[model samples]
Target: MSELAVPAPSRHQLALMIWLAVFPTLTVLNLLLGGWLGDLPVVLRTFVLATIAVPIVVYGIVPRLHRLRARVLRGPHG
Candidate 1:
């Protein structure tokens, strides 16, 4: 049995990927929350953002990014 070769990203690359994913997530949340977020305390705001962002980044965006990366790497057949 042959396994596909998938190289893991380095620490810096992983950090960059996470930052890329999170920056957009935070931006959208900020836009959606708007003035309402300002009324909440910092901790509450952070909690709320984390709650919403985590699943989106984990289950949603990350998978898509992985698939996209695979497709890109695989070229036409992918």
Candidate 2:
């Protein structure tokens, strides 16, 4: 019998998707927050801050944790 194979998301692919998702949200938030200039609402300002913050956290923190988990569970090759 043949074994069934499943596709998985590569690190790069996952990163790209995350980046894709982050970008639009950030852009909207950026526009909402005056797009790096002019006056804007407080809620929009907060959203803008969140947009910047979420990417940094994802790029820096989430990936690091994933790497650690991969190393422990699946070894460094992953």
Candidate 3:
């Protein structure tokens, strides 16, 4: 049997990637929902934010970041 050739990121790297993806997503969500969500209980607000942020982070931002990882890592010093 042939193995697939995909390279998996380490646990630390995956955490970093998720952090990068979630930060901006959560920021935007907070900005958009702040007024409406502010009155809600902390747990409920967090749940709503997570619900909206997860899909966007997983399906949208994370993939784009992975695709651009090399260039992003190169930075201005490169």
RMSD of each: 2.5, 10.1, 5.7
Candidate 3 whole-model C-alpha lDDT, 0 to 1: 0.83
**Rank order by TM-score, top first?**
1, 3, 2
The RMSD (Cα, Å) of candidate 3 is: 5.7
List clash counts for every candidate, in order: 0, 0, 0
Total backbone clashes of candidate 1, pairs 3 or more residues apart or in separate chains: 0
Give candidate 2's error at residue 14 in angstroms. Answer: 0.4
Reference-based TM-score, model 2: 0.39
| Sort order, lDDT high to low | 3, 1, 2
TM-score per candidate, in order?
0.80, 0.39, 0.76
lDDT of 2 at 70: 51
Q: What's the residue-level lDDT of 7 in candidate 1?
A: 64
Candidate 3 lDDT tens digits, 1-78: 543343566789889999999998999899999999999999999999999999999899989877666445655443
User: Candidate 2, which segments miss by more than 4 Å at Cα?
Assistant: 1-6, 35-48, 51-78
Best-matching candidate per TM-score: 1
lDDT of 2 by residue, 1-78 (tens): 542332445888677657765666666656765546456677866765786769766776556655554555554443
| Candidate 1 per-residue lDDT over residues 27-58, each given as its tens digit | 99989995888889999999999999999998
